[model samples]
Target: MSDEELSSYLPHQGDRIRLRVHVRKEEETPRTKKNKLLTVLQEKLEAARKKKTTSKEEHNLEDMRNPHRPFGNRNAAKQNRMIEIGWIHKSNQRSTQIRKNKGGGTRKTEIPRHATKVEIIQQAIGLFFPNGLSSKGPLTNFNFDLWDFADREIDANVTVADMYERTKLPILRFYLATSQKTNDIGNTTDA
Candidate 1:
């Protein structure tokens, strides 16, 4: 087989795995709290406006004419204060790409370094088992509670099945072994 064909037949390389993780922007606060603070600020501004209008003769109308000036210094100051207090958080929509390095450490591309091995493993498991253990009867019997602990404890190179095997967890081992046998039998029958 040609190199291209051989490469296609082989399993995907580890470098190909890229996981996106949400990270809060620097100097930004939480969205909900920020919105709330903004609302309060708006109310205060309106109340001040009303008071100014009522006492227009006493104070100059120049400052009240444009509360938000062309440069918006007042608005900017409010935003800065909101960030300082964590009332408004950075946008989490922009995700950072996390790739696992050969040595097992993760490489985060872009800002907000945030992906961990456990998070990546959990994401991979979610992708692998989209419907969770509901569809797989044997898997339902297997202990899934160990996933988080296993992800942390096991070596990065080891496959989930291999990790389960290493644990000598009877339910998981039996399920996987039997499943393999069933697949083998099915293949033979098809042939």
Candidate 2:
């Protein structure tokens, strides 16, 4: 499949497909422990697919409306929070949406898909042999969780960098705190 088609299957199709999916080798994001965790999650989701409880989130017209608060009420009344639980097509428009609203920061390319009555895609790939990849058959079975693990690790690194930039911490302080023997900051999940 072309990159466009491949990119379209991000979360899974079939408004009912849980947040789970798999990988073989090529389609797999990367080789890492984080990806492994994601693959495990996808497998678990697949297992639960029989129950149909792991399905995606469906959207309603009311979800698009803005919340309105009545007089003397601190919290606004909303029909329902828009919880995107399904796959939506990706595009450049999504990234610049925040810019249109006059918000700061980088463009958020990835937006949660709005679940509605529509067709979805299902594809899988492995760290070695990604599903739907333009290649010969005989795709290998791999621990899909590696993809998740790698993604998480990448996010973690990105988070750390964002923290450093946002917190504006001094280089000396960061190294000193991170090098503590007893505290062993590298073992810490904290930034």
Candidate 3:
């Protein structure tokens, strides 16, 4: 009779369709590696400055301290060299990556860098686990073998189901268990 009334014909056929969805998007501050590192360094410098009783005096830490402590020869040039000036020196060990090979031996491996001047790995998120969701390795203290092996065939967004479809690991535990949620339905009126 009324517009709000549900009719039998309308119930059989779909009267109207309503789409509902909750969309969440996060806008991360796009920070460069150097920018983040420099900010940290600057903070450290500022804190050091604040702690010092001296007025506007930059702390020459190693310079003032008696320099002839170490076992190295007391050459004046090397004395100045101890105080690292502008840049930090990376290890010549070539990329901090080492792996064991077959035949009971070890081999050196290096991942390609984005640039000539080694960009500080400010964000190693996708670099390590592209899946966004961390694997069991990181949770435990176990070493992640993802980097050592070649890239996976599946996309970063691929889940357990996708992996199961591709290869092994069909981890289907809850079937009917998840069909309808089991709950002890309680109400204030019943009480």
For TM-score, the strongest prediction is 1
Query: Top lDDT: which candidate number?
Result: 1
Error of 2 at 52 (Å): 3.8
lDDT of 1 by residue, 1-191 (tens): 44455456544543222211122232254568888899899999999999988787544465577665444334322311110000000122331221222111222221111333343444433433446532333233322221223223333455433433355442221111112112434431110
**After TM-score superposition, what is the CA distance of residue 82 in candidate 2 from its true location, in Å?**
40
| Model 2 Cα lDDT, one tens digit per residue, 80-164 | 2121111111122231111212221121121112211111111112111234221222322111110111122112223322333
lDDT of each: 0.33, 0.27, 0.28
TM-score on alpha carbons, each prediction: 0.16, 0.14, 0.14
lDDT of 3: 0.28
Model 3 agreement with the true structure over 1-191: per-residue lDDT tens digits: 43335344345323422111111111244367987899899999998878774533433455457565654334322311111001111122222322122111122222222211111111222333235323212312221222212222223343333333344422211100001122356211110
Give the candidates in order of lDDT, highest first.
Answer: 1, 3, 2
RMSD of each: 37.3, 35.6, 36.7
Clashing residue pairs, backbone N/CA/C < 3 A, model 3: none
List candidate 1 segments past 4 Å from native: 1-113, 134-140, 143-191
